[model samples]
Target: MDNKPLSFKGLRLLVVDDDPDTRKLISILFELDGAEVLTATSASEALEIILCFQPDVLICDICLPDEDGYSLLRKVKRLDIEQGRITRAIALSAYVMDEDRQYAYLAGYQKYLHKPINLDELAKAVNDLAQLQQYA
Candidate 1:
């Protein structure tokens, strides 16, 4: 699993998920990858963190206790526009339908990963997105 760190060296990341286990799992993944990671349990909490932290990337779950990830992303992007900030986003979800994927893209997620997270793929996604975002 390349578990010796460095997969995401120096990257600042925020993960939003209502599920405690999901948040902890994702947080640990990035943390082990050498990222400075933060977690939020809801969309509102995510926004709060974004304002103060201005993280390099956002890894979020589609189904949240407060709001859907789609709308949360819209809000995040809108704030980015207004504040001249950029936060690359990845959508994590249990929805495995093609339509769900389409919605994620339309909602502005740079990438999407279904449940049963793959560490390699997720790290690769962060790597690719970081390259595009110029953080890698």
Candidate 2:
């Protein structure tokens, strides 16, 4: 068994959040799990990074400094299609309502996770989404 103890092996992850601590924590954890992570403090930065980084997956906070995660995901999804690329996205928020979850799904996020986040759940979500990309 090539057990390197990784849940994000070989994944390129883009983490977008306004909170410095949240961004840093996610980045450190994912990096430890063998993922290449890039973080953006705002939706604009995320958009710019998406064009260049072309991450395999995105983990975005629902509340952003500029635009919300829902809007950001829509823009990112459109841009990806234009570039003939496929990217997966996950939404993280403190909002734990059924409607919020529905909105996130409709906004192009594959998974919606609540905050304060569970690191293990986040890792599993990333792994699951990355696996789905292989089929896409």
- lDDT for each residue of candidate 2 in 1-136, tens digit (9 for 90 to 100): 4444547778899999999999999999989878899999999999999988999999999999899999999999899889998899999999999999999999989999999999988987888889898788
Give lDDT tens digits, candidate 1, residues 42-114: 9999999998898888999999999999999999999999988788999999999999999999999999999
- Which candidate gets the maximum lDDT versus the true structure? 2
C-alpha-based local distance difference test score of model 2:
0.91
Per-model TM-score, in order, reads 0.91, 0.93
TM-score of 1: 0.91
Candidate 1 residue 3 C-alpha distance from true site, Å: 15
Report RMSD for candidate 2: 2.5
Number of colliding residue pairs in model 1: 0
| Clash-forming residue pairs, model 2 | none
Q: Model 2 — TM-score against the truth?
A: 0.93
